[model samples]
Target: MATIFQKCKAKGDPCRRSRCGHSWTVRYREPGGRSGSQREKNFPTKREAQDYGIKAENDKREGKYLDPSAGKILVRDYAREWLSRRSIKETTRKNYKNFFENHLIPRLGSKMLCNVMSSDIEKMCQGMCEAGLSRRTVYQSNMVPLRSLFRSAVAEKRISESPVALASLPRLKTKRVDDKSLPGGEAVGAIASAMRGDLAVSVWLMAGCGLRIGEVLALRDTDIVEGAMRLRRQFVRVKRDGVWKAELSPLKAREEGEWRDVPVPSLVEHALRHHLRNHGVGADGYILHAHHGGHVLDSNYRTEFRSAVIKAGFAGESWTAHTLRHFFASSAIAGGLSLLEVSRWLGHATIQITADIYGHLTPDAGARMRSVMDGVLATTNVSRDDS
Candidate 1:
């Protein structure tokens, strides 16, 4: 039984109990809140009791301390919360969710949010690379999400610092070069030859006017007036419950940037009139559908374009649906249109994208410029000779 005592001395102090065998004494309060008696303990030596008392006091302090529960939170729980707080479009959110579900959670869900160290994350990334995932994918899987999680943890006071601060990962490289443009004349011919339904007319607009796939699909019959096609909305496919389907959403262009009017070529206008006359518009009055009814999903056009490419023998090399847009831009540059004009036609937010993709055409433009300069020089020399 433990005793509560006060004014006691440990053994080996000069004060000794001559008659009793007890070697040491202690001064302590009783365990209860009441007044207590002083007590002394027998010790083989003074050092023993002194050491025991010091250890007991240390243990008491430790027992009274409370550690935080922040380290106990799991990585998976915080990840879900983080995703919910992000302000991204529905399609973008779906993509992030897929990456988290398929790649992130399965690997690191069991980790404690606060206790996840940099070494653990680095090992996970190395493992992913060894497993044949690309460097870009590994960064997406481990680096991006871990950084976001640790940042949140710091904000919530769950972690003191992000462990991945010094980590390095590979940068994403562009998958392929951007030179797959076809000639505009060939594009028009392909559209004319491929006419079987209203789809053929939409193909003509896309190839001739350089419209995006989404923009082309979202057109309404009423959008065309006086031989001009109006661009307003863009259709995008989003994943819902693991299935991807088209949704006719508003244009993703910036504010006050929804619509553009493109003049239709004579042949394209004839085709459009033919499609509208024979098929008639749908209840929604979209122009580029079977019998001019129902909205055409972008996927439908991609499939038809690929089929057309194969039929026209353009499939052997690098022609794709997007080749038509590139073809339009390249042709415009080749036809003496300024980069600024081409940029506006393509609805680019900036002219740099237009110049980067089509800047190679400047060489052709420069050749013609040099010819005109030489001709002017020759005329000046001939006038001087006549004088």
Candidate 2:
């Protein structure tokens, strides 16, 4: 147990003021029995000092004790150590570096780790919005890192609690993402016909199979089955030491290596067969080619796709590579596939995610029920007038 004492001044001759203000001091032996007493002084009241000492002792007993001095480390230095200890994906690391350099360090880096509070983070979020950052960017790039670092700090015993634990976060912006611009089945035919060679097959796969552009670019000869394709990997462009290059990475999910056999539609199969017959497999074993050894490069693919869109009489940016994937998803839903089944086919991490993005496409049975009940339960009488 800790004890508090009134530290009265010694018998001084000059300018004495009420026993030198009667400073209260709480003193206790270190809980681990390895050192002398830990003194907490300068408290104005004995109750306050006692409260402090009791909380400290309780924390020590619970194995949650943090040295008060340790939290005095600057946020910037601690953040560096925190980042060094993390092994994250290239894209994730890129975002972390961007947030650390632009948002976190400039604002909170000089402050002590203990001084960062929930309200301060809220203000930062509001300030970022006022400074013209999008709501999603403010929440994702600012508030997220602040909350995350504080969590790490608490786990490392540098601070007692995460400040943002109770903070009301900004709402992440989500527009209704159902693919409406796609003009049904004819849209895919028009777009794919405008492109030449493997570029044509790429379009068919993306539109017909719900394949990501990166995944389409990364496909190999071994991935093709009779009427299905094994989606095992994706081609990603990542920056290291300020240089960017392509890398083959596993599919994105909780289980990174998960591969799904997506059924290839007849049109997609025809395109793939045509390409394989014309180009065969490249020296590097890519099933398609762009007339430049092996698979098509990302920049070249985008360039040709833009030209194709222009030729097909559509705005270059309106129907993107991802738009085709959305087209595939919407078409599948319209063809009577269940939401859960579509989510698995889409390779989403959760059904909730698939629902959030594509749930608008599903018809509302509850609305139909409300309509039927309204007619059956109507109180107003309908008159048959014969004048």
Candidate 3:
């Protein structure tokens, strides 16, 4: 950090009918170092110049000074640089690009980063929602990029403060769209029963063990060891040249590529064995195979699942393959499984993630409260004595 210097320019003589003009200039180095552009500001009086020079010097010493012109740089230039520096997955990169192009760049690309305020951001978010954008898209695509951009600007001393932290953000509901539409325990069994062959086995795995569809598709005969099945990776689809292609990747866990075992239920084991004995599997030994023994895509499962629900006497129920996963975790919690245990079985990144989804579905909250209240009243003996 360097100190600011005050330079005063004084007029030596006045014209016959005019007064002499005088001004003060405060000169300072740009925030980074001496290599930066030369900076100077002028004031009408020496006292004002000295005050600002002192403040600038102190701010520079404390690392709070930002160049007034630094923020004039367009957001597009900084955002593009920010995106280029990040190492991310292909699908994630594609999504971020869409967010930048579709949501943010259209509205804020030309604007300078420092000129934007939290109110502008709040209005942008409200406008997106008002324009019928989903809450998920608003936060993930628009708000996240905005936050990251301003955060970087502050770190680089391009701006003195972040607009994101300046105010409260608009409400964005975090619940999944299908949270209300997931099937109950009875519906789970019926759908599993309606499926046949590989679909049947896959549904049972989702319903009984809560394995994700990607993990189910990636399950191999080689993964089974000592009556436990390992989930180390998932089948992901990445786009190339505007076409999605299947690729195997690590699970989206706290530790990337995390592997965990799920204890096999007798029913799931029976269903898996039945499919294995009759149909075998793809060359990869995948338990769930697409037509012609390839990876089973979501498109393949959705068509079959739609028919299965109708066939299972659940014609009016709206259910997807993911619904089975939800039902299994909720049912497990209702049936006396601890959240910590169920979280492990479902391979959740944290117990909090498991509780966030199925926490309200747990039956013990009301039941245990009832038991505790009843016991407390019984021990008090107040009801009998008053009677």
Candidate 4:
């Protein structure tokens, strides 16, 4: 049986020549006729000494217990290790790293992983909000990394529980803007009028076929066959350490039910043919290329496209590259295509997204309930004349 004083001695050595001089001691007896005795130098309070001793004894009994030798590990250290194992795209990883380095680390880096409580996380979020970050951006740029860090700690048994659950942060409020769709007929004509060279073909593909910017840049001459384009690859620019690098990768879910061939409109096909004939395809067979004969980067088109938008007086108005995709989906739906078909064309994961984003565009959507009610009344024949 261990006494409180004996437990204190088991903790470790205490400073010698102290005022109270309450030195707790421990003795270890070996089976092989060997005995060892150790004494803590001195403690001011017997209670402090006893508490330390009890913890040490408990740790000794439980092999799983480990005393924090260098204090608790900081949140920042765990975050780095967590990110190292994440299987995300290069761009996503870079963004996560940036969020940690720029926002999370500077504020909570020194906080002990085990000691961080829900209050600390809530305060951090409030600070970010006060700093003028939008609620959505704050969640993504700060809370995301913190949540991941706490989750990792829980999984590694570094801490028994995650504080993220206690934080109970609310989702950011978002207004679904009616911003999806191509520019109006006048704006489209203006863009077409202003665009020359390779830019013209790219814009045409986006507006006419609903191709994403990445898909447009990834298009190759060989991809166009028999008035159809095979969708396979997408060109994306990922920021690595503050510099953007262009990469050509296969489209996500290109196999196992996500891939499809899209029919090219006659005008788009003609424009593609003209661009290929005049500029000639790259050695890599890409239809779009930089002036120096490499893949056309998003930045390159961004500058040119923004300039064209402004010159056409659509700048600071209802026009963006993605709007062209919206335009394609809207046009397809209005032209008597099913929602599922439109979703497939846009490479969306589900038709629900297609319906949600563009459901308001249906001319009869608002009157659907009224139409149903009218049909019910007509079938019952309880009209005013009958009454």
- Candidate with the greatest lDDT versus the true structure: 2
**Per-residue lDDT over 200-236 for candidate 4, one digit per residue giving the tens place of the 0 to 100 score:** 7888888888898888888888888898888888877
Per-candidate TM vs. native?
0.59, 0.82, 0.79, 0.67
C-alpha displacement of 238 in model 2, angstroms?
Answer: 2.9
Q: What's the lDDT for candidate 4?
A: 0.72
Clashes of each: 10, 0, 0, 5
Tell me the alpha-carbon RMSD of every candidate.
13.9, 6.0, 5.0, 8.5
lDDT of 3 by residue, 1-387 (tens): 333333322335433333234566777776667686677888876678888888887887787878887788887777788888976666666777887777677777898987888887777777788899987778655666677778889998888889877856755544632446777667777887888656788888888888887788888878876667888888878877887777787776634557888888887788888988988888788878876888887666778888999998978887778877787787788788888889998888788777777777667477889898998888665645555
Candidate 4 Cα outliers beyond 4 Å, as residue runs: 1-73, 141-162, 179-182, 225-228, 238-244, 250-263, 313-318, 333-340, 348-359, 362-387
Candidate 3, superposed: residue stretches over 4 Å from native:
1-24, 30-38, 43-55, 58-72, 176-186, 253-256, 344-352, 363-387
Candidate 1 overall lDDT versus native? 0.67
lDDT string, candidate 2, 15-97, tens digits: 35655667778767655665744756568876788898888779778887777777999988998888877766667667887
Which regions of candidate 1 are displaced past 4 Å?
1-74, 110-126, 134-166, 175-184, 225-230, 238-244, 252-271, 333-387
Candidate 2 accuracy as lDDT: 0.77
Q: Rate the local accuracy (lDDT) of all candidates.
A: 0.67, 0.77, 0.76, 0.72
Instruction: At residue 40, give the lDDT of candidate 3.
Output: 80
User: How many angstroms is residue 287 displaced in model 2 relative to the true structure, after the best TM-score fit?
Assistant: 3.1
Candidate 2 lDDT score at position 382: 73
Say which candidate scores most in TM-score.
2
